[model samples]
Target: MSRSTYVQRTIRNTIVSEKSFKETLDSFLYELRFFHPVHADKMIEQAMEAKDPKVFDTLAEEASGRFGYLSFGDHKVHRYLNKFNPNRPVLESHAIALGTSPRAYSMTKHNQEATINFPLRITVTQRPNDDRASVTWDLPSSQIPNLHLNKTLANAAFFVDDKFEELIRFCSGTMDEKKYKKILSMDKGAKVGAWKDAGGPTLSKL
Candidate 1:
């Protein structure tokens, strides 16, 4: 069963206190850096350093990216995307897909074509009403092509959701970052399971 390359979730917060809001944004940047992304910093710096008027939205947008953050209107968005299709997003309504490479995630033993950088976007919206806010997990693209071939992309997205449940901890006020589960252990375990049936030519000599 083929799955759409898109996934999105919106979590509404009833009590978006000023302090909690600030902490959320700070934690967001912290989480992005925690993975040691390769391309986000330069893009963030250029956005910070742009002196002249950034007139057009396009010129305003690339100030470079794929694994970077940007702000517009009520939303603050950051994405690590590859193979972007500019026709307009089919799932998430946010349009922050500035084109470039996708090398945000760390390399894994399972996705060793060096091609498994997850194509994801995080959109935090402070709604028109100051009291309401939402965090949307927008998966506008996936790291794997099985998105349209089978339901693997959807399955992978589900796995990611499970690993990162603590992301919304600001809503509850106790974000024990240390308790967050290891994100790629499932992938490693899946690889090991496949190894049990290792074929004729690829068995390890060791």
Candidate 2:
């Protein structure tokens, strides 16, 4: 079967059983593989170490901001994600779709064809309480003919519920200026922003 078909079938079988939660966790891990292996490895470590669901939720919040950490390739049907908390989320509601070009953004620099990795259409919504937001994920029918995916994936928000019990301490908050510069030199994309470029460093928003 095609990879797409396999993804569909795997999702179908997984979501319908007692292991639904576990399946959801696996689905995200599988999708992350399209990106950097380091990300997937780290995520798995987090999941395994998470003492409970609450810990996983915290990790997801942090991971969502570092999507760039995952090594994403040319194209793949990974996932559409939304984090619904009564407060600000790591990811607002958004749609992941197949496209010939990228979307306009300070990130993409309004250049469509420059990067075609995992392009998604993002729409930010604010509820009356103005704290909760819901993001929708769907393939624009006009873009793909008869797109069939487990619609459940759209609602499969917040896969893992807690943080991993085991954690790696490769990154630290303090460093000598020269040491920091050396680390930044490792990843040319290294940038200082909400999301650090490949090797650069950034602080988490509170």
Candidate 3:
């Protein structure tokens, strides 16, 4: 019964040419494979193997899974952020007990206290003759029945925004590789930091 609300923005031709841009985009997607639920490598492999028009949709479905949607092309990438389950332990144990997949279990109970998730998405694009690429951040809406539980999960959206902003800064050469690596290295709980008080306006809109 929970649904996601959508938010979006764009970054201009940051990369020089189409070829180089796609390569850079590929590298970025490659890095995302380190995270669970992304399945970036598998998506890429399948996309390449299919070599058909449906490849993009295949890639999107694989990358998004239950979280949301992610799609890539010669000049753009679209990400639809859904809630992320932090309690991997609980989800995994439940999966084992129920004889179901963890991913399936998480999808069913992503909003539960044992598995709170956030809503945030980013889109990157490059237009012809443009000197920069347009990057947009979208925070969707979702309902959490309990007020206390809602408050705890709300800050996660902004934290995700900050992390993506950091990634953009890294791509733009403003943030050094070492610092960016450190941010990427952080666990989910550590990433929330002091921003917990920032509140969940996006979630409230749900």
Best by TM-score: 3
lDDT value, candidate 2, whole model? 0.27
| Best candidate according to lDDT | 3
Model 3 clash number: 17
Count steric clashes of candidate 1: 0
Query: Candidate 2: where are CA atoms >4 Å away?
Result: 1-38, 66-206
Clashes of each: 0, 19, 17
TM-scores of the candidates are: 0.33, 0.20, 0.34
Task: Give me the displacement of residue 105 in model 3, in angstroms.
Answer: 13
Q: Report the Cα RMSD per candidate.
A: 14.8, 20.1, 16.6
Better of 1 and 3 by TM-score: 3
Q: Sort by TM-score, best first.
A: 3, 1, 2
Per-model CA lDDT versus the true structure = 0.33, 0.27, 0.35
Kindly give the stretch of ten consecutive residues in candidate 2 with the minimal lDDT sum. 160-169
